[model samples]
Target: MSDITNAYIPPAALTGSMRDFRVPGGIDLLGRTEGFFKWQNLRRQNGLWPFSRATEDGPSTVCSAQDDSGNKMRGVNFASQDYLSLSAHSGIKATAKEVIERCGVHSAGSPALVGNTSYSVKLERKIAEFLRMEEVVLYPTGWAAGFGVIKGLVRSADHVVMDMLSHSCLQEGASAATNNIYQFRHLDNDYCRNILTKIRAKDKENGILVVTEGLFSMDSDTPDLVGLQQLCHEFNATLVVDVAHDLGCLGEDGRGHIGMQNMLGKIDIVMGSFSKTFASNGGFVACKSRAVKEYLRFYSAPATFSNALSPVQAATVLKAFEIVESYEGRAQRDALMANIVSLRHHLRGAGLDYYGDPSAIVCVKMGSEGLARLVSRRLPELGLVANLVEFPAVPKGAARIRMQVMANHSEQNIVKAVEILKTARQQAEVEFEDHKRPAQFEARAVA
Candidate 1:
């Protein structure tokens, strides 16, 4: 028999990331993917896989959930991205039902043809007004909007200067659009200025697009928009801000950092999604020029080839915006901020550290991936629901639990989640200390 046993998976594999499996090694196109499968299988068997989980019931502060293997769970939910808790709002539901009855469920065609519902057109106008811009183009998802905007406007010869920690959609979109891409240090305006100055000094003929986020979800922080905008203006570059995480649930009038920074209509391009705050599945790109909007509608493959937002989704988002701009919306933001404060306060009191400024996304640092995976495995069993973000999302050793707080989360939910998380981590720490690291690649079955 071979020296390698049935349980012999490489030690490198244990420490490996999805990044390693991205490029296939062999010539067989289909079979090249098997290594990743086997590695993933190992993670599953070890109870280390924590992705693709499902919810058994409708969303709320607490939830009934299921893990990747279908193990049912119920707990204090902090995994969802419903920052305003508007998904369960009565008005939103009633509006969705009414639109489904009146206009049916399908958007049927792309917006370039027969897809633009009256509701969508009005939604576009309303969003433009809300952002104090002139025109808006809608997309099926926020990701698509981010991708479409860059792909539509930028060319292969043009340049894209982006924040190092920007969302993957923005990064992928920039990659898709051009090879002349530059990355500035995260939230470092001076570094951004240096890159912009270099680009302008060398290539004054082509376009340059600067991409950033209103609020970075992973770090729960924001950029100095005014400074970046000034750099963009000085360099003759365009700026696009992705407001996916903070648009409707943050700031005084719920305009997110854009309004908070007093750059409402001054931005070159604005992109956001309804999923985070509007309680629907849609996205939009707003800008000052009718030309940019028209150009994106036709040239953007995501918008041109995909079905438009359904009338119900469009109407639901419309109603969400109405509520988002209302007095009730202010109360919701206040409540969300209150919950964020409570969670952070209690986490500190309990001797845990969290990352970033006060916003809905609270990233509690958990030092190593080994301990984090153990804690993740123990959490649902401990009656808490949260997400463990490890290597490839954040740095390899800087694992964290990304808690998505909501306006409706009760004080009890916050306290209980913190306690359960603390308990789970303590238990994992004990197990980690006792278990001594596994042999590098032992010739033994996991059983």
Candidate 2:
């Protein structure tokens, strides 16, 4: 069993502290926010936070980021989730510009009102057709789509069984929608089957929703979709698969893990984000029936209350969809897979341990948060911009440097990145050893 199974905390236990007014001495909302910022400030000061810094250059294979010292430094970028490098594609940018000029910038209204334009409608249709679903609904962002799907479909009496390592959006949705939520071990279909069986035995009337992701971003792994679908069928449960990281970037036709598992239309619902591979900042849910789609559209708060995808966002995604289905998309996927293979081979040859299968995302195991942070901080200086993921995202001791491969990255770029990473790792180890010696001596002196 993974550490998530032992350390995972339900979302309900962590949300809505405002209602607990009777607590004698507890952190309020503002206090909680302040605490987070304080910690973030410390991380930023140490060059460990490494988030939301301005990028002076395009989000390509190699890009420039403004450092804390206000220096623009170019590096091999493996932090972006643009698996196909479509975000910087000339055709996508041109379509976005054309659509903005034609329809203006903002929708200025919720999708349920006047925000649903022809571009969004046509994009929805295109998505449905591409994913082999009967209908589709769009959201302003991917997080909203995942959260909306559960809250729209499930009620208080319903039950939700999900993977322990599922996305925060999915967990939050389940927590908000229902109280009877159970999380199985990560990627453990047998555990999921047991949970479903127990739940079905107790409640035969209320609905049961089984949720998992097409690809777990932090761990860089996937679940057995076919097996999970079978279990859901046996228990008369609905299966919702979030393909945010894999859709339009994986499988033979870029249909994601579902296609790879030969369970595309067999699953109850398919949902994903457009930011990763579709070259826009939005999300969608594809289902087999118009009635279900309409119900979600009417009930999902993000769809009903939030402004819809702007014309440019919708058009860019539509053009990206067209490109993804063309020969160019196939070539891109080939290049992406080749890059992943090459990087993994190099890492292994250098005696480094990595997690996950042959996917665009690869995680080098760093064992501890301190080591991971040190390595990540050193990486930018070594000409690599990578992400360091630690506690609350993964298990306590399983910190790693998450690297994302792109189709635009050449062999030379990958080789250079790996070499720099090796050097960074060595430097981090030395720094950590030097930092630890003082603490060890202090403890010894105290004893």
Candidate 3:
């Protein structure tokens, strides 16, 4: 097993992080950003920073892209979020085109006003029915839906108990909604129970929202949903599961962990995004209460203030749901699962360590940010396209390569990806050790 706790001694220029530049010292808020820009630019120039890379084509098993430096790259893509390969499905694309011709582009207003197209309404109902819940509200993006649910339901006096590894949307929503925010260890149900007990013991009058994810993207893990939900019931709390990464791709019926764990229609709140497996740009929150749905529509700033999901997006998601509910959906899920298993098996055979259970996400542990950065720099050149997860996303030194498996990824893609990844890592490891020698020599000289 690899020690994920290993830290790195980066060069003096790359020592600090974006986190270091967050707090402003001077009165000028805009000027405070210069420090972060300086740090980020250094990373961009060296190909160490991998954010904001642009893809030349649509979603596929292979990718052609350009990094921050605008250098061309063509490789096997393992960074896309399209779990079931639904983005390019003929039905999905056709629906988008048909809706665009009929309804034009924009929704014209927030959903709070006249933005509820027939497609949006149907999408909400379909999600509610699929989840076995009573009502649902739509949001412009997955992040908005996550933030809105907590921000709309919980208030200043309420308490939010969450898993420490919950999505940033949930955490930010909790932060924005109240001051009494509490987090337990990742997937630690007993720790969650303890937090709930402590919160209830001190204050039983306020509302409590317990937040968790169906599938954590970074770690590729899920919590014990049943246990967490039972704990919520015992403590008079509401459990909101973010199914952004797993929904529409996992489980027998594609209800994600909530279904696999026999939790359908039982969760207090269900929030998810269409961007992952649904092949669209929208999100939804489903619950058993109509009142709660209405409350979120008006009170959730994202829904009330932001423009509603475009008609084309809503229609595209509707078509995706149509496919996800049919026999074809089951086949797609099976295909996706097969790819996930194959990729994981190959990764293990390559003598690489990955964290968490088998899912669409596969986080291959890299141990140190320095080695990971070098490996990332070598990947594109080695004919692979995978995202490097490092500081701010994970612990500072606990970097990893996050591979998102798609149903369309063939055996060749999986086999070749692992080969290229291993090659890149080997090349980077040699370069990294040599790069460390100078710093080590300097320290020994000082000694």
lDDT per residue for candidate 1 within 206-247, as digits (tens), equals 999999999997898999999999988898999999999989
lDDT tens digits, residue span 1-447, model 2: 222112222222222222233233455655655645555555565566666656776678889888665745679888888899999898988888888889999988888889988999999999998888899999999999999999999999999999999898899999999999999999999999888888888899999999999999887799989988888888999999999999988987998888888886788998899988988899999999989998998999999999999988889999999999999998999989999999999888777889989898899999877777777777776789888777767887788888999999899988998898898888778756655565654554455
| lDDT digits (tens) for residues 202-254 of candidate 3 | 99899999999999989888899999989988999999999999899998789
lDDT of 1 at 93: 90
Give the Å shift of residue 68 in candidate 3. Answer: 2.0
Q: Would you list the rank order by lDDT, best first?
A: 1, 3, 2
Give the per-residue Cα lDDT of candidate 1 at 62: 90
Runs of candidate 3 exceeding 4 Å displacement: 1-10, 439-447
What TM-score do all the candidates reach, one by one? 0.95, 0.91, 0.95
Give me candidate 1's TM-score against the actual structure: 0.95
lDDT of 1 at 181: 94
Worst 10 residues of 2 by lDDT: 1-10
Whole-model lDDT values for every prediction: 0.88, 0.84, 0.88
Model 1, position 150: C-alpha lDDT score: 95
Clashing pairs in 2: none
Clashes in each model (backbone N, CA, C under 3 Å)? 0, 0, 0
